[model samples]
Target chain A: MIVAEQKPFAEIAGFVADCNKILVAGCLGCVAVCLAGGEKETEILAAALRMHRRLQGKPLETVTYTATRQCDPEYVDAMADLVKDVDAVVSLACGVGVQYIAERYPDKWVVPALNTRFAGGSVAQGVWEERCGLCGECILHKTGGICPIIRCSKSLLNGPCGGSQYGKCEISKDVPCAWQLIYDRMKALGRLEWLLEYQPPKDWSKSRDGGPRKAVREDATI
Target chain B: MNLTTESRLEKLLKRGEFVVTAEIGPPQHASAHEIVHHARLLKGYVDATNITDCQTAVVRLSSFAAAVHILREGLEPIMQMTCRDRNRIAMQSDLLGAYSLGIRNLLCLTGDHQSFGNHPTAKNVHDLDSIQLINMVKRMRDDRVFACGEPIKEHEPRFFIGAAANPFADPFEFRVVRLEKKINAGAQFIQTQCIFDLERFSRFMEMVVERGLHERAYILAGLTPIKSIGAARYMQKNVPGMIVPEELVQRLRKAKDDGKNVADEGVDICVEFINKVRKIKGVAGVHIMAIAWEEIVPTIVQKAGLYPRPKAD
Candidate 1:
């Protein structure tokens, strides 16, 4: 799922400071699962903004609503009436959602309340870790299921870049070296030879470098 | 006769000579004056000096421009490029730019994370990691084509590629395998992270020798003379991927209590490590990273008897 965290209350507050009435938008898809821009987060931000405005003797009127998914135009269009009724829209979703909202209502002042982090999973209760870089090409089949694109600090194709001690990254004790994890896992599977295959330079054209990419299925077009 | 012998540093390593390279950190503020001064200080003492690209991820004068300054002073520069600040487009363009400026030796690194330095909030563009970068450079040189297979007909950058290694970093057994991969990716020479744990480094190098990697690439041991006992302690406790053994800290502390200059003791330690490391099989040279104290580098190189670097005719 897409992981994200709310921007500081003050920053989010500043985004809508000039507006007296605004819509605090939320998403029920990836952000909701990650607990970032979910329904709860939307209300929390709405309340925080209201209190902040109240303290300044300028109370704010916020209408909080969550769409099934903000990345989809149809779901985003559902918020059209709510968006038009308010002075601005505070998107409590991933970057994709914020942009989608802006695209749907071109004139509506839309802003992001959360910083989209990465494609990751919940490692523990209330904690999330990044696991995928969204690199168009996925090599997980050969890497022993470890994604170096996101897990390795350097995103090295052949790594554990001399900074792996005790299976941890050299960057910090909190982060485990992705290559070390892969090596150990591959060793366990007796497929260590998979690492010796000399992965070539990544074809970044399939990645963000190729500019905004889109996927299409001819058979599913209908 | 490797086509890359065009660079003096590469030639030195190819001849099996103990090459010495130093790091020249460009000043944060705009001024090439300090950079030129350091180049002069290191000119005769080291075979080539590296101009770091925002070493530690702090913003600085771009290393491509800094290498031009070093080259202007008639000193060969090992231009450093980090993935943190550039995407593949800028990276490839900068390589051509730096090479056109007369910089030959190249060091590719996956730079320190932005959080490790100032401007922590800045977005990083690590579009290409170090290993892939080495592979890309090799492609550009040998294939004489861009990464996308577009051919380049003019001023192809013939570089002696280099990469970094850290023997003390975890999964110690895998460090050698990583080094081999970097070489396979087209790194001709390597400079390790600072070496304070000799026993551990010896074991790492033993693995390199066992694989006959030393025969393929020049391996330069990284040596950074501790400025003080406090600095040593900080590195031991705080520096990521660095391990300052307990004995070195005790020795530095003892020197301090004895009222001996810690900086001098630091140099002694550097010399001692160089002497010991020089004897290790597969070890080719020492890369002196006298970071802020660049003035001490000439003295350190001299003390290590690497002064009067071999001249490439």
Candidate 2:
């Protein structure tokens, strides 16, 4: 899932300082699951913005709406009536959702209230850790189900690099060395010999190095 | 793998001489004065000098340019190349450029993370790891082909490839295996991380000797003389992949408390490490990384009886 964090209240307030009325939008997808931009979060943001404006010797109006999925055009089109009266739309969704809202109401000002971080799942209750590099190619079978592409600080193929100490990366003690994890996993699985084989240079053309990527599904298009 | 062209350090190591190499950190400014000064200081006392490449990811004069500066002073330079800043294309280009500029020895390394440097927000380009970088250089040199395996047609850069190892780092049992992997990837020599814990380094050498890895490539023990009690404490508590034993710190503290010169004690400790490691079987040479304290390298080399450096044929 794409994890995101809500922007600070002051920054969000500053974005709509020129506007007298605005709509606070939220999403029910990844952002909501990460407890960042759910329906409850949207109402709370809207109320807070209104109160903050009222205390500044000026009054402001705010309407709130939560989309089932802000990335889709249809869910964003549902907010057509709510956006007609507002000066700008403050989207609490990820970057994708902010663009969707902007595209739907091309005339109205649109701004993102959350910063989309990484494609990761919730590791603990409120903490999320990245697990994928989106490299467009997977080598999990060879690495004992550990992903070194995103986990290793150097993203080394035949790691751990000399900087791996005490099972942690040289960057920080908190970050576990990905190669250490791979080594332990491969050892447990009796696949230590697999690690001995040389891993050649990766063809990064399949990754972001190839430019913005897309997925095509002809079967589902119809 | 035996296709070397022009590296004095490589020749000395090949001749089984206990070579002594020291590092020269290029100035953060563009001045070449420090490189020349350090080169002159180390000329007769050491085999060759290593020009660090923006060590710790702090921006500085490039190692290639620094090597050229040192080479001008009649000293051979083991030019260090890190994988943190450049992609495969840029790295290959630099390899060709360095060779064309009369640079020979090349040390491949995975550079320190950018967060440790002044430019913390800079995006790192680890397109190739140190192992991959070594292999790429080998292909270009031994195979007479570029990293893409296309013909170089003429003048393929033949570098005396080197790589770094950290025996003190964890998954400690696997450090030796990693060294072997580096050797397999065509690293002609291995310069390990700084050693403060001689016991652990000795054990690491035992494993290297048992695997007979020492026979395949030259292994240089890395040494850094502690400058002061503060430096000792910093390396013990802060430096990554470093193991500074408590006894060494206590010795420095004892020296300071007794109103003795801490710097001299640091040099003594470094010379002691050099003497001990030289006695261990399969130890090829020593690479001293006295970062900002390049002056003490001459003293350490002299005190360790490694002076009057061998003239490589």
- The DockQ values of the predictions, listed in order, are 0.49, 0.76
Clashing pairs in 2: none
Q: Candidate 1's residue-wise lDDT over B1-313, tens digit each? A: 4556479887777777898988899999899999999888888888888889998878899889999999898888889998888888888998888777788889989888777788878887767778888988988888888877899887778888999999988667667888888899899999999999999999999999999999988899999999998899998987778889999999998999999999999999999999999999999999989879999998888888887888876
Positional deviation of residue B143's Cα in model 1 after best superposition, in angstroms: 2.6
Highest lDDT: give the candidate number.
2
**Where is the poorest 10-residue window by lDDT in model 1 chain A?**
A158-167
Model 2 C-alpha RMSD vs. true structure (Å) is: 1.5
Q: Is the docking of candidate 1 incorrect, acceptable, medium or high quality?
A: medium
TM-score of chain B of each: 0.98, 0.98
Interface Cα RMSD for all candidates?
A: 2.0, 0.9
